[model samples]
Target: MVIFMLVKDVMKKPITVKDNDDLTEVIKLFREKRISGAPVLNDDGELVGIISESDIIKTLTTHDEDLNLILPSPLDLIELPLKTAIKIEEFKEDLKKALKTKVKDVMTKDVVVAKPDMTINDAAKLMVEHKIKRLPVVDEDGKLIGIITRGDIIEALV
Candidate 1:
């Protein structure tokens, strides 16, 4: 039986980010909220792109002739920085890097946005093919309305 439903009907409220936002801030939100991704919005609040943990991971470790140049090893990351040890200059530089990186830097700019009137099967198929856990639901105007995740699909299935 065909599940004839629009993505808007099942999508969750979106957690969004601006095009000029610091990716580091986004990362914190992801960790606290346990979400894999979020939508990126332009100044006019249009759907620009999507950013996922995998995207951030790519930035941290790019393939360089079979060598990886990752910053702050997993063990070192666990050691929380003391208040005094935190240098303002260093923090500022990191923030600058994140802002300059732009949403386009790590976001999936070639997006496969879901329209309100797509079948559940079609959406699921796209997600599977793209290896993405979520799909942003948008209107014809390219304005984001919500998002649908694998969890949402599973909940509907059961």
Candidate 2:
């Protein structure tokens, strides 16, 4: 009989971020580690949220303007120079806001998590159902211990 894998058996030690961490620092971590996302923890070491690349992109794109300038479209083609200038200005403002923002401001607070004893099959199902790439593994006390990703599951299966 094939024994099913458990989350703890496949999960890796998580790279986590504090709830109050600066978004700039988090971005640096993402680049340096080459990871797309991480689990967010509170001062008490409880998993409170998850931050992903999509979250960062969403935060940066939350501007008041329509921001849907399609280049080469008839209207934009007629005012190329003016449109270019306006886009550059908007880019500067958005960059400033992104740099100044905090992780807590953009993190998804309602994080879905996995238990150490959960079957890998169940964990994979959870990830698919939630449309998430990873799940923070928590112990009975609700403290983050490890994280399981789609890659981890794939590696185990193969």
lDDT (tens digit, per residue) of candidate 2 on 1-158: 11398999999999999989888888899999989999998888878899998998887775445445545678766787786788889889888878778888989999999999999999999999999999999999888899999999998887
The TM-score obtained by model 1 is 0.72
Off by over 4 Å in 2: 1-3, 62-83
lDDT of 1 by residue, 23-63 (tens): 77778889899898999988988888899988887665532
TM-score of each: 0.72, 0.83
Give the Å shift of residue 52 in candidate 2.
0.4
Best by lDDT: 2
The 10 consecutive residues of candidate 2 with the worst lDDT sum are 62-71
Q: Residue 122 in candidate 2 has what lDDT?
A: 94
